[model samples]
Target chain A: MEKFKKNERVVALIKILSDNPNQVITLNRFSELLNAAKSTISEDISAARKIIECLALGEIETIPGALGGVKYKPILTLEQSLEFLKRLCTELKDPSRIIPGSFIYMSDVLGNADQVATIGRIFASCFKEKNADYIVTIETKGITPAIMTARAMNIPLVIARTGNRVTEGTTISVNYVSGSKKIQTMSVSKRSIKEGSKVILIDDFMKAGSTIKGLKDLMSEFKAEVVGTGVIMSTAEPDHKVIDDYVSLLILNDVDETSKTISIIPGIK
Target chain B: MEKFKKNERVVALIKILSDNPNQVITLNRFSELLNAAKSTISEDISAARKIIECLALGEIETIPGALGGVKYKPILTLEQSLEFLKRLCTELKDPSRIIPGSFIYMSDVLGNADQVATIGRIFASCFKEKNADYIVTIETKGITPAIMTARAMNIPLVIARTGNRVTEGTTISVNYVSGSKKIQTMSVSKRSIKEGSKVILIDDFMKAGSTIKGLKDLMSEFKAEVVGTGVIMSTAEPDHKVIDDYVSLLILNDVDETSKTISIIPGIK
Candidate 1:
């Protein structure tokens, strides 16, 4: 095996930990992989942690038990989170984003991979302690951020289908009222989630929280617990939603189709 | 700005470059961000690249000239790709995954974030040279891998809806035959993809190639060229498909419903 210097070990450590966020990596494995000593690996981790903290590049946690070693937590600082949301608000406030039906043309924002991953990291930071077993979202627009959140949190992403598809095999479904007041059905594979598992419900946008409520109802069928709920954006109207106690990154306060202007602000202060 | 040691600098460089894959980061930007001299940052990058190559993490390319800079490409070497695929095949071979309709229950596999990211990295390695402007896929299953692939390539992900949703503004719809011989409609927002841009179509499964064909048709309406098509898995019985040029990670050779057995092998030699 080839010997690695401290710089090389640090690089390898950061890459491996970043790739598998929130998952523990034993020191012995790193020692074997890098052909380094445990003490050297420990020192390397301290150096990596310092740079990560100094640069605000998430958190590197060390678990001190026999089963513990090190793990990367995608926790963004409060300042970083606010800065990102503020920037997102500006991008979303562009006049040209307004469509005929007062809808914001956000396909470009939601479709950008790097941007979505950043949003995912923010969410992961927000609900890091919920200890979620899975991140759940309905199909279509929500999958992008939900999958990213799952990736950041190092968890499985369970996407409920708009309707039960044959490919999913034995799904439990629930009907929910959509933003347009139309009744819609969503379903999840029966085996996708386990009973009594803790889950986080993540959505791209929330209007009345009906979709979140419906997802909650579906989770009940599987006997799973909804530990956290997060939405990238939520409408400000209707003051009271069907379900409260959810974190939203941005608030869509108003949209003027005639003036071609949109008023969006950061949510949750 | 706090000065960083060589080990710390390597850690920060790996974190930043790993976070933004396939995207260029100039030495000046690194110098400003890390509070290091340009020449020092260059050496740090060299150290990072050496360890990355040593561990088969990916490639770090240094582009030359005025617009040149360092970029991280998520290209898994041949050995790594085969190892991942073979392990996936072994996992998929478990008889418990067989559904009543002979459909394999792949929700768990598709929903795994870290594993899916690995698959995305493999796809990125497969299509890295295509220089696609965007990664495109149809709704639901394909979105996970597609978004991950887009993240790996540092590009945008464009998803075509199964049906025209009111949320998406002015979509272009196309009707095509599904694998089960049902005519289905898929649509993409008119402004979602740029006209005359190059795109890569990604799908989770290809059966009879109708879904992939439909997505290609939808891409054509926008005057976008389909530079490459990739599927995680493709069935072998058809022996013929609407499209001939594509890459598949795995081949589903057979599924015996009675025996609850599935035979899947790595595709593309």
Candidate 2:
């Protein structure tokens, strides 16, 4: 095998680390793949790490021990985060997005790949310290962001379905009242979650926080715990929420039907 | 502004291109970001591109024109694809995965981040030439693979819900027979897909191809054309399928309930 140059090695290392975020890659693997010595691989990693940190692209943590190596964790600077959110607020201000019942239409934004990935990285960074075993979300809109977060954190994604399906085999179901004050049933495959696991809950939008609370209740059925909760947007109404501890990226303040005006602000961290 | 070293520039270039696959990045933009001359930036991109191709990580296409600079596209070698499918077949061989009615319980595999991403890349490569405007899939199991493909293709994902929700605004619903020979209603938001657009349908599993057909029927309602369809697995029992043209990675041939045995193989391209 031919040895790779410093530039080529750096490029490959960045791609490998970025693709498998939060997962350790030993120096031996790099040395073997690039056909280089351990010392050369170490220098290459250091150079890549400095570039990542210097640009505030993300972080590379070096673990010290026999079972340790290096792992990448994606991060965005405060300025970058605020800039992205502000742009999101502006895009969401379109009155055409106002649907009936004061609901904002954000399917386009939530479905866009670039936007969803950026949001996922931001949410994953926030919950990285929680040591979550899984990232959980309800079916439909929340799956995209939840999947991205799961990829970023190198964890499994457990989706709570609205009902059971034949493909899911036996399932455990839970009932909770939705924001509309209607009782809804949410179910998950019996084998999806293991007992005593810590999970982070993510969703596209939050209103009365009923769905999130329902997830918490559902997690209890498996003896699992909800370590953290994150949402892209939450409404300002309902004064009091079903759950108090959660993080939201945007807050929907008011939507004026008469003038076709919408108001949005960044959510409190 | 400080100039970036070639090693740092190469790392950043790979990260940016990998993050935004299938999107073009102009030389001027890189020069501005790195605070270097266009010639220097061009050299960095060439180095990065060579490294990517040498490692079979992906491809960087440099279009020569006023509008084009470079675009990244992810690809997997045939050997890599076959190896991945072989491993997947082994994982699915466990008799415990066989549920009642000979259906396989694959929620665990579908929800897994790493496996889903690999499947997504394979599917995306298969359908990349279609230039799909949106990736469409039904709710629940298919969302993960669809989202990954959407991310890879740099497009939006439009999910068809099992039922309508207030959050989705007005929806167009269609009824079709599922593999269980039961009539099911699937709906998508009215604004999710634009008229005259091309879409690709993706799903986790197929039996009788009823769900894919349903998605096709649903897409026609919006005047959107279904250019391609892909799935992770399909059963071989259904010799005659609802959709004749589609790609599946794995084929489940037989499952003996009495002896607790299962048979699986790679699907024909």
Predicted structure with the largest lDDT when compared to the true one: 1
Model 1 over residues A118-222: C-alpha lDDT tens digits? 899989988998989999999888888999999899899999988778888888989989888889999999889989999999999998899999999999999
Off by over 4 Å in 2: none
- What's the C-alpha lDDT at position A137 in model 1? 94
**Model 1 clashing residue pairs (backbone):** none
Best by DockQ: 1
lDDT of 2 by residue, A1-269 (tens): 87888989999999999878889999888888899998998999899998898878899999878877899998776677778999999999999988988788998887887898899888887888898999999977898999888888889998898867777888999999977888999999888898999999999989889999999999999999899999999989976998988999999899887889999998843
Q: Report lDDT (CA) for all predictions.
A: 0.90, 0.88
- TM-scores of chain A across candidates: 0.98, 0.97
Per-residue lDDT for B145-198 in model 1, tens only? 988999999889998988888778889999999888989999998878889999
